[model samples]
Target chain A: MIDFSNPLHLLAYGVMAAGLAFDLVGCIGLVRLPDVYNRLQAGTKCVTLGTCLLLLGVLLRFGFGSMGWKALLCLWFIAMTSPTAAHAIARAAHRAGYALWKGSVGDRYAEDDEGRNIQPAAAADRPKEA
Target chain B: MTALDVLMLGLALGVFLCLYRALRGPTPADRAVSVDILGVLMVGFCAVMTVATGKDLYMIVGLAWASLAFVGSLALAKFLEGRSFDD
Candidate 1:
């Protein structure tokens, strides 16, 4: 139900719709994806982007005077922390020896467990150009 | 219900869905991931409340909740790693 009369309303609704779409997609991916690493990837990236967009819409609607600055703060806080938590979770999972999905292509983590460098196998295999 | 109400309903549904995943997830890491998502959902819920109620304080609640959730998730991940920094 879009109201074409007011541009602000239209913009707010559109942004909220996009955010909800991302949220739904991320949740579905979390449920459907195999393995811890894959779930983490889906949940972290999609939710962060979705929530940020959702808050941005709120900020725009409410204007920076009231809900606006608070929305900005929440968005920034989530952006800073979500990825760090995701990295921590993934690293912890790998450290705890959580099994990768059977269809996983390769394991740079397997090759370099402690150092946690996630380069492709070919990079390690190829000779230096020099 | 208005758009904000609808959004809140959807967020609540998402929370329940994630809770199921957290409960039924096989491994510790799986639960941890879902739980982290739950914290984000908490923030969403608070934000919606702020909008619907017109209380800027709810947004502040959401902010404080977000950071606390992050700390909790970090601790959970550490626990999953078996170091039990949570303890």
Candidate 2:
């Protein structure tokens, strides 16, 4: 049972507000972003950080307990996994031939994938039928 | 009976709002992102519920849900790609 009069309670409130604010801001990025890849950049990284802070606040208020530990572990798991998952999604999108934003100057994945293609193994090999 | 309880309840409602977004999302990617966010929100909601209810048990359920949410999202995304999970 938390004592609302306790200063620690104030800290908890502040943490919750800040963390939720960050999370909502990340959502705004999702709504406003130009493309899926760009949205992934905002959504995965920012939301993970926001939720981690929120969990940390919960941990602080709840004290050292199983729940606290579980929260920390969950935060760590999300921090590691979310970005990797986003990367995988992006790679899949690319492979499925989703075009990059045309006005954008760069296409690194296209270049890298093209570089790996094997041009018809020595074109001269005795096949004159056309 | 308290301000913390009120605020926690509000957060829970906010979480539900996020959940609505997750369910009706327009794209697989949107749904995936929402599921991931919603998992964290669920954890946050459970933590606050623990505080509000003075019971730690809900946190365990929340954590378990988080794990399951991850697996479910991964499988859904795989399914979208026409990949078979049974293999």
Candidate 3:
């Protein structure tokens, strides 16, 4: 049996627990959020952090073995990609005209039928499309 | 069961929760984000399984999966960006 008394084991266990909690909470947010933008934000930040922490725990547990090295590489890969993926998804969602939540305060991307931005000043002149 | 095994179990539960989100998400974009979360969860599972089983191959599998997930997400995003994209 593995020695749970070891400091490394304890640390890995604790980090993994924390990562799991974060991941669960992020999933909850994804399900309960009112809009795609909010979901994107939650998924990008929470999952990236949770997955990286989990990887850190793995590195600690595995030391300098191939598993550890691969974990390290995966961590870097995720840290770099998750946000970019989120941004791309969000931009595409916005361009696709996925409606914002009814409670949204403002829409900077709102455009008139003439392809003009619709701000407060242009509210009266806003075309029918926006 | 060892602590690592329990942790892996929890990670699996988390993966299921992400799947639920992916299923119930209202819009294509929302679903896309769910997919992102799922990919990350897969990586976490891979990490835990490698250590628990004392195997090294799971790590490489996790890395390759992550790379593919990234590319898939980008392609999905591009398609959404241009809904007219046919190919």
TM per model? 0.87, 0.75, 0.85
How do the residues A41-94 of candidate 2 rate in per-residue lDDT, one tens digit apiece?
776676667777777777777777876787677677767766766676666555
For residues B1-87, write the lDDT of model 2, one tens digit per residue.
Answer: 565665565556556655665676556666666666667666666766666675768777767867776777667566655568883
Write model 1 residue lDDT over B1-87, tens digit each, in one string.
778878877777777778888999998888999989988877877776776787898888889989998998999888877785636
Writing each residue's lDDT as its tens digit, candidate 1 over A1-130 gives 4457979867876787687767767888888898888999998899888888788777866788778998999999999999999999998787676777878776666566435565434345533334
RMSD per candidate (Å) reads 5.0, 7.2, 4.3
- Candidate 3, residues B1-87, lDDT tens digits: the string is 877777777777777777887787767777788888798889888877876787888889899989999998988898877654555
lDDT of each: 0.81, 0.64, 0.79
Clashes of each: 0, 0, 0
Find the 10 residues in a row with the least total lDDT in model 1 chain A: A120-129
| Top-down TM-score ranking | 1, 3, 2
> Where in model 3 is the C-alpha error above 4 Å?
A108-130, B83-87
In candidate 3, residue A56 scores what lDDT? 88
Best by DockQ: 3
lDDT for residue A126 in candidate 1, whole number 0-100: 37
